[model samples]
Target: MNWSGWSIDRVLILFVSLAYLVIGIQVTMFHYRQNFTHKAMWIPVISSPIFLIAGLILTWYNAPWVHTMFMAFMWFGALAGLIGFYFHFRGVGIRVGGWAMRNFLIGPPVALPLMFSALSVLGLIAIYWKVR
Candidate 1:
């Protein structure tokens, strides 16, 4: 289906991109609060489902680059969630160690959103590029 030269695949990509963007915003806001310290949170409540749905959409559409990007984004989100869990349990004497752990703990809030934004820009470019 085409909507004024926009194909359904492009539309789906746009939707997935927007979903990630919104999720990124929510997670970043939560991080800014510095308040995930006490809750037994295993995942980012907002981003997990949003990204899950976006992943499903990308898979269904079979868009190669977008789907790969979504998988990478999900991996990052999961790693970030794991770091949060480790931090939460650390207060009770639990410990975790890995070289990447430090990066995960410090980077997700900024990196995740930028990834989503980049995906959005790519989708927009795809939507507008001349279909030869």
Candidate 2:
């Protein structure tokens, strides 16, 4: 209701946030359903979707606080991704490759979380600009 001066910037940032949420959900669900063996690591996989959902909810209402909320979610997601990557590379031994090489057995690992981190950082910058 308080959408005072909605502009392209706001619209774009909001769109990016929405895209982030959707992509995150898709990745999380696909990973969960595919890998039933890694029960312990599922927490990080599962928590991301919830964060994205919260980000979507807060962003939808055009709330001023959305920036801070998103900051929290994105940062958490980023941290989780970093930790996941470390463990995967160090201990999990999951194969990594380009998108073209991806198959049923090996999904994109490093890229997804890295993408999340990069996009979230972009989202944060966009939020800052919007607030400024």
Stretches > 4 Å off in candidate 1 = 1-43, 94-132
Residue pairs that clash (backbone atoms under 3 angstroms), model 1: none
Q: Which candidate tops lDDT?
A: 2
Best by TM-score: 2
The residue pairs in collision within model 2 are none
Q: What does the lDDT read for residue 52 in candidate 1?
A: 50
Model 2 lDDT tens row, 1-132: 567766655565676567666766766675666674556367555665666565566556667676577667767766766765664444324444422344323643555656666666666665666443
The window of 10 residues in a row where model 2 has the poorest summed lDDT is 96-105
Score candidate 1 by lDDT: 0.54
Residues 1-132 of candidate 1: C-alpha lDDT, one tens digit per residue: 446875655565566555665665676566557665545332455555666566556635757776666656655664654565455434333324433566456533334435444544554454445656
After the best TM-score superposition of candidate 1, give how far the Cα of residue 109 lies from its true spot, in angstroms.
22
Worst 10 residues of 1 by lDDT: 90-99
* lDDT of model 2, residue 15: 66
